[model samples]
Target: MVASLSGWLQLRHTSRQLHSRLAPFSTSHASPSPSSSSLPQSTPSPSQSQEKERGAFSKLLLFLPGAITFGLGTWQLFRRQEKIEMLDYRRQRLEMEPVTCTRNNMASSESLEFRRIVCEGDFDEKKSVFVGPRSRSISGVTENGYYVITPLIPRETAPDGVQTPVLVNRGWVPRGWRDKVVSGEEDLDKPSTSSVASNTGDEKTASWWNVWSKKPTSPKAKEIVVPPPVKVVGVIRGSEKPSMFVPPNDPDSGQWFFVDVPMIARACGLPENSIYAEEIEDEHTAGAKNPYPIPKDVNTLIRYSVMPQDHLNYTATWYTLSAAVTFMAVKRIKTKKVRL
Candidate 1:
């Protein structure tokens, strides 16, 4: 009985050793517990979540500039279309025959802008305003000049026996000939007293009045002959709005840059809403020798200030940049996805 008991104990020990050897393999092959498998996967840390949100936000930021540029490009295209339409309208108006411009028909000046018109009037030479220094391209030569703005009184008087006049941009004159034009001189070839004095040094010789007061002699005023009542052919022009870069018109100082219809009318003692017109140069007189006041041609009057080609160029530039940015953004997104 003792031998049988000892043999049974040995068998029990051998079985315990085999069970321990198989325990590691069983654990390795076993499926996860239900509680462990179902537990929420280790939740992303606050830092990791914030990093993911930042990545999305950065991607959006990359598209913002492209979107803005794309919108600007579309706006430019619209502007280009508007410019084209405006130019077409102007061309149509210029093609039509000139209409008679009188007090009766001058009320629709806005519609008549850039349209040629004829008016019978006499110029008020005393109320001439010089606006300068404008630059002109004459026969491929750039010349600095001033525009002479004169008031024209109609042959017919108002009910109150007052002549309501219109403002006319007579034409452009050389910078040195402003006084000659103002003095109603047909010829600018004659040298002025100031020029003679400067050439001959006559200014150094002081007269009795000048020697005592130490002041320069004032030149005698030239007689201005009023032009007879005549017919003027011109295009109706609207009031000019000064750009931010343009300096304000100084009426007190008589320094005029751009044509401000209202301000110029007030300065010249005319009605605030006086009609403004730019004289069209006669084709016959275009080749006249040294024409003091050279009027602008029909083409110049109807030309667009900003060309449509400029807008087209801007549109192309913006669109190209937008496309490039979109391509790069998409590529970056794909790269990130591949890495993830």
Candidate 2:
């Protein structure tokens, strides 16, 4: 296949060379005339002048290469413009939709578009697993740990009859922390921004239970689901924490980053494609884990999340280069015409 393509390319090159040797003449518009001829108030007949002009044009035929090059440049510029516009449109549209945590949405049926969804149910903290993340490690490298994701039972109280429990990616913590998560011993009230601190329970628990807590990964196995249900509002999303370049000193689990949605559901003892959700209220606010504070106008969230690029400036540059080459090629071909 490769050899065939190479041969075809070689043929094309030869054809282009032949065309270049003949193009200047076809594109020429000049005429040949004796500029210094002194006549007795008489000029060549119209047919004679036209014949000379055509002969002069025939002398130019070396410009097809530059024309083809300019055409390709023009095509690239057009493609670049379309891509930039599409990205711009997506950026603008993303603002109206909520920005939820990435781990909230796991594919359920291998067929679904990611979108906003509300789930009603309390978390089964006992069955959750936290994936180790290199993005937030202290050794300047990835460490052994997991991102804690608990299932949230979804319900609808707005007279809408919607109820289901979706998964919630609470946050990340080191490996040993799971066993250390004694209900009464951990303190959740800390103004820290490290990986461990990032996973501390938020406004979900009572004054006592809300404090630093490690909801088990299997609440059913622990027999701990006896309580009022917790309601959650968030968005559905994809999660990924790559371990592509972590030091090998850490446990192999640390190297096992990036949420394989299928693997995650299977580990939960659920079918491989269970659907998940991220919480978000109609009253907009900064997204959880958002580096910046929420803007007063929630309308700007999508714009903030899906930022635009300065590609139009580059597009203009490419178009300008193409136009310049084309113009120069045209001018050169004109210069090649013979004058009589």
List CA RMSD, all candidates.
11.2, 26.0
Q: What lDDT would each prediction earn against the true structure?
A: 0.77, 0.48
User: What TM-score, over all chains together, does every model reach?
Assistant: 0.71, 0.38
Residue by residue across 1-340, what tens digits does model 2's lDDT show? 9999999999999999999998878766454446644454676788989987885664443344445655665665676667667556545544445333223333242322234444445455555655454234455886555555666543344333223345555554555564354233543221222322223334444346645567633322222223334434444455444456743222234233555555666566665556654334344333334321111222322333222333445545656766676677667656755431
Q: Candidate 2, 273: how far from true, in Å?
A: 1.6
Clashes of each: 0, 38
Clashing residue pairs found in predicted model 1? none
Q: Residue 99 of model 2: what lDDT?
A: 31
Q: RMSD of candidate 2 to the true fold?
A: 26.0
